[model samples]
Target chain A: MQVRCPHCASVFPSDRAGTQFCPRCGAQIHVPEEGQVVEAGLPPFAPGAPPEPSGAEGPGPGEGPTPALPPGVREPTPWERRRELGLFKAVVETWKASVLSPRRFWPSVRPEAPWTEALLYGWLIGAVTSIASIPLRVWQQRRSVDELREAAERLEELPARLRDILRPIVESAGAGTTGDVVAQAILGALLWPVGFIILAAVLHLCCLLVGASRGGFGATARAVGYAWGPMVILYLPFIGWLGWVYAAVLAAWGVKELHETTWERAVGAVVIPFVVVCCFACCLGMAGVGAAFSSLRASP
Target chain B: MHLHLPPRNRTFGFVDALGVTGAVGLAIARWVPVARIVPFWGCVLREQTGWPCLGCGLTRAADRFAHGDFIGALQANPLGAVAAAFFALCVVASALHLAFGVPLPEVRLSPREARGARWALVVAVVLNYAFVVVQTRFPHLLA
Candidate 1:
């Protein structure tokens, strides 16, 4: 039987009744007996689309039990309560919840919240992390150049063939200047949002491909944004990249909770894209090698 | 990946895995004479084509970077040197985080941004390959 979600006004085909999750909005819906079925002609929201405006009141109390904070209702993250908590506190609370207490935190993440809010949070974290890590990356690059130049001075003692081969490497060592590093750093900070958004899209696409994405793109975007909590490690020396792993795991958890999907599907949504990209890159690389071999043979 | 991190002291779960893998990798790189064992381990593309492949000098670059010969690593392959430094950084950072219980942050992106990152990576790879070609085939221009 077709039942309309009283909370979000989304209509979906349902065979079973009782306390069940709306595939579209993930709201806990209580379907009534066939005699009590009210055929409301409200325009249904698209499947996996953001919740409609709350102007439409749910069925009178007689219809069923209404959840206090309906899944269709937008539950604002701490970062969104900047006016009440102040900006710093909001950021801190949100980051803490996302990274440390994700099990409790992800369920609170509403798929209906404006995706831009999460996007802004991710942007702030990424920009800060990039700016903080610049010093370390710059130091590493500088050390690399200095070491190369020193080795070049001793190249004279090496065999002629080896020296000839090493000369180009030495020449290119100084290719990146301080100015260049600064420019790259600035670009990275500015482009943080773009990178994050793309990552979320890829993951969402994977979710869709695997038939796992129950929530709209907004949910996926929010998941990826909140996942930025782990990226703070970027500010520290060494283990910054581990933030990527942690963030990925957090995002997957968020998807499972917000989308109301299984762990296998949520994890698959994240892993499939990575596997596909790696396989594609390997093939592309092999093709390049093959082309190079053919060109070499043709030249002779 | 269904790898759950406990609510409270989450650092211990994966720290051991990272520590073991990193230690084993470093030990092999430091103690084992991999270069001697694989004497013919050179870039086949470079050997036949007179032009350097994207990964042509990566091994040499890694070896130099591992030995604290940053300059030699850069001279061999700038990308490879960067990668080696990044690997070392991850190992050390993971160890410290496990020891100190530092909090990690999560990161998320929108679809547009994800596409942009992929494009940016592609551009970086192409640019790096171009640099390798210029340095190898036309060294005078750089000089």
Candidate 2:
């Protein structure tokens, strides 16, 4: 019996049962049961071309044929798709996308990317910000020194002993500030990983207490790491504070998405730790004040 | 290619590196006699208002502490030695974590504990800053 290849429109003798490739064109052909006539005159079906609409009913205007796909293929996830462009590009693109649309972007990031990559991403961003701010820091420091000098000059009317004491403090201003830029950059980069760990632990604890910790610690860490995306703008003058606020918002969004929890829970997870830390700080301040008062009372 | 280290291990590595770098920096600062040549950006608050900030002299103090000058470190800034100790501890903890997969214990403070810790830090900073201010402003009082 003869068969026609639907894909290449090649005609060949059908010697095998079930499915077979056309001998002339290599198009897959399905052999029929006995007594079926082969349609040998149909046009060849291009491998990647979309299937034509049924006879007498073509696709209407604005309706395009769907692209053909090989079997067993699936669309890439957002992270995988972004990563396909290369690491640097992926980092830049992801950071941009995250800053612009954190609500949408963060939810799309699954916990599949290694947490270390996220930590590195956060650290690099922090380091860039620190390096960029070196000039500003230097300017601020110089201004401070000038102000100190003026203050010391004003103290010239005080007792000679007082002047002697202030002299060393004022004079020491000129020492050991040269390599500060490198120090700041290294410290900034190094602090990020530690910060992330602390943040993750606090947030995870809060989530657990609040009964919203559906996701594991890994997911929470990933969320916090990606939340540092907004820190890319930390070098921007005046508006730099906004970057931190945006980062906080993004972190909440990330927690919500990653943990599949309520918005309140996510926000609480982030905010509660901060509140606790603040409370602790306040208590310490009060105790310091009380102690100072006690010492003053004890003094003549 | 990405590193095969787990996230926790990577974090440990970063913290450990930071601690080492800080220790090394302190060590160098102790040995180097280039203090007069290097510009010290002293405390801006003190420069502007004649009052020392909480962190004033911290770098110098840390350097002194790293060099085993405990008295000098205390006089420079009491908290400096504490900060140096923290960095040292971080280094040790990170090493243990990396080698044994043992993680830092999670802090789960009760409300009372949180309040106490916060108050303690606040008091420490305030008292320290007060000491600095008095020591700088009234050098005769100490005598």
Candidate 3:
């Protein structure tokens, strides 16, 4: 159930329904059941990204071997070339990974620590730190809310645009009464913190289901979308095109699985559908208009 | 712009656990004061000095903030005000969402705007710290 990634020092849930690699960071996770696949090796730093150069620590370079510079001058050997390339490649990839791109790092659910551990370990690791930091947290929370509040006021046509953006995502969530959809969204907006926490918790559970659990939820910001439903509040201030995007992603992820889980867990099941319908509708709508316009032009 | 809420709302699994954790924390803070956690009598390094340490009143400050005594909370720790306000917002907003499917459509800030907001908060906290230092050094400044 618990597997550690040698490269990243990460603990993951490896007891998958089937074989799975490290889902978070691409690493060769040893899955006991996967006897033959073990040799498949770690998903390279990236597919087709190329390995390190020869003569360096990583995979050798692409060159067969360094050729003689001139009749007298000597050249680096293949092993040397490979080593240099590998090291260079590794450093570059690490830097790229470290300096996050919104596209790569910021997803719908960022994931936080395992709820059980984050809270408990927090209690032990000097509760004062938690207690003392309350003010800072408060400051941050209010700052976020205040921003949302103003944005809501300034954007007079937010509803219309939101509808356009939200429609497709909503449709995907599943069918819902207008009131129900609105209420679910509003609920998501209001109790986002709790929603955020619960969202992370549920996501963690899902990761376990998939057998590629992440270690700690990590920082709150990192786990931002892990609890997408409540993050609506977080977007309140932005109330812009980007804010709408966050809302759509959260709703879509939350609702996508609602129908399946609704039967087993009636209440959460309801939310899942609601989120799905809303997010799906928004995404589809956005895509649909582009398609319609393009098709119109083509017909002419 | 238009905001939408799902007509129906449902609770998730983390609710019960969060509730229990929060309740237990609140109970401990209320019933057992932090100072009591220390021994009543012992030879201590700070025994010779009468002044409180920088972090002395923080626990009480948190307790007061949690209890909703905003003024008392601020007096205990300036950061207490911000924390109290935020915590109240969180609790209120969450309760509203639970009772009614729609969350209270409140305000928010994007990262861009927060640049200015961050400064404002910094100034407030700094001023609060100044007040604390002044009061501690010159008790008469309290008047």
The candidate 3 chain B region of ten consecutive residues with least summed lDDT is B39-48
Task: Put down candidate 2 lDDT per residue, A1-300, tens digits, no spaces.
Answer: 766665465567766665455677654445677825454322212234322111111111222332232111111223345556876777777687677776446544654345566666677677777777777767766776778878877867655654554467677764436476458666876676766666665566565545344444555666777788777667666788788778878878877766565688789878877776565455445544444455456545
Top model number, TM-score = 1
lDDT of 2 by residue, B65-135 (tens): 77888788888887777767666676677667767775554333333444454467669888888877888
- Point out where model 1 deviates above 4 Å: A1-74, A151-173, A276-300, B1-143
- Who is ahead in TM-score, 2 or 3? 2
Instruction: List the candidate 3 regions with Cα displacement exceeding 4 Å.
Output: A1-300, B1-25, B38-56, B65-70, B106-108
**All models, DockQ values?**
0.02, 0.03, 0.01
What are the interface RMSDs of all the models?
16.4, 25.4, 28.1
Give residue A141's lDDT in candidate 3 (0 to 100): 56
TM-score of the second chain, cand. 3: 0.62
lDDT of 2 at A84: 68
The whole-model lDDT of each prediction reads 0.65, 0.59, 0.38
TM-score order of candidates, best first? 1, 2, 3
**Candidate 1 residue lDDT tens string, A34-88:** 6344233222123454332111112221223322332332346789988999999
Cα RMSD to native, each candidate? 19.4, 18.8, 28.0
lDDT of candidate 3 at residue A288, scale 0 to 100: 49
Please give, for residues B6-86, the per-residue lDDT of candidate 3 as tens digits: 344433223332333344445555677654443222112112243433333455676876676767777877775565455
lDDT of 3 by residue, A1-300 (tens): 665554455666654633344666663334555433232323212234221111111101221232221111112211123356674453333223222332222221112222332233222222333333344445555554566555545544434544443344334333333455345444534443443454444443332222212122232212333222222233223443443344444333322221111222223323443465465455445444554454445542
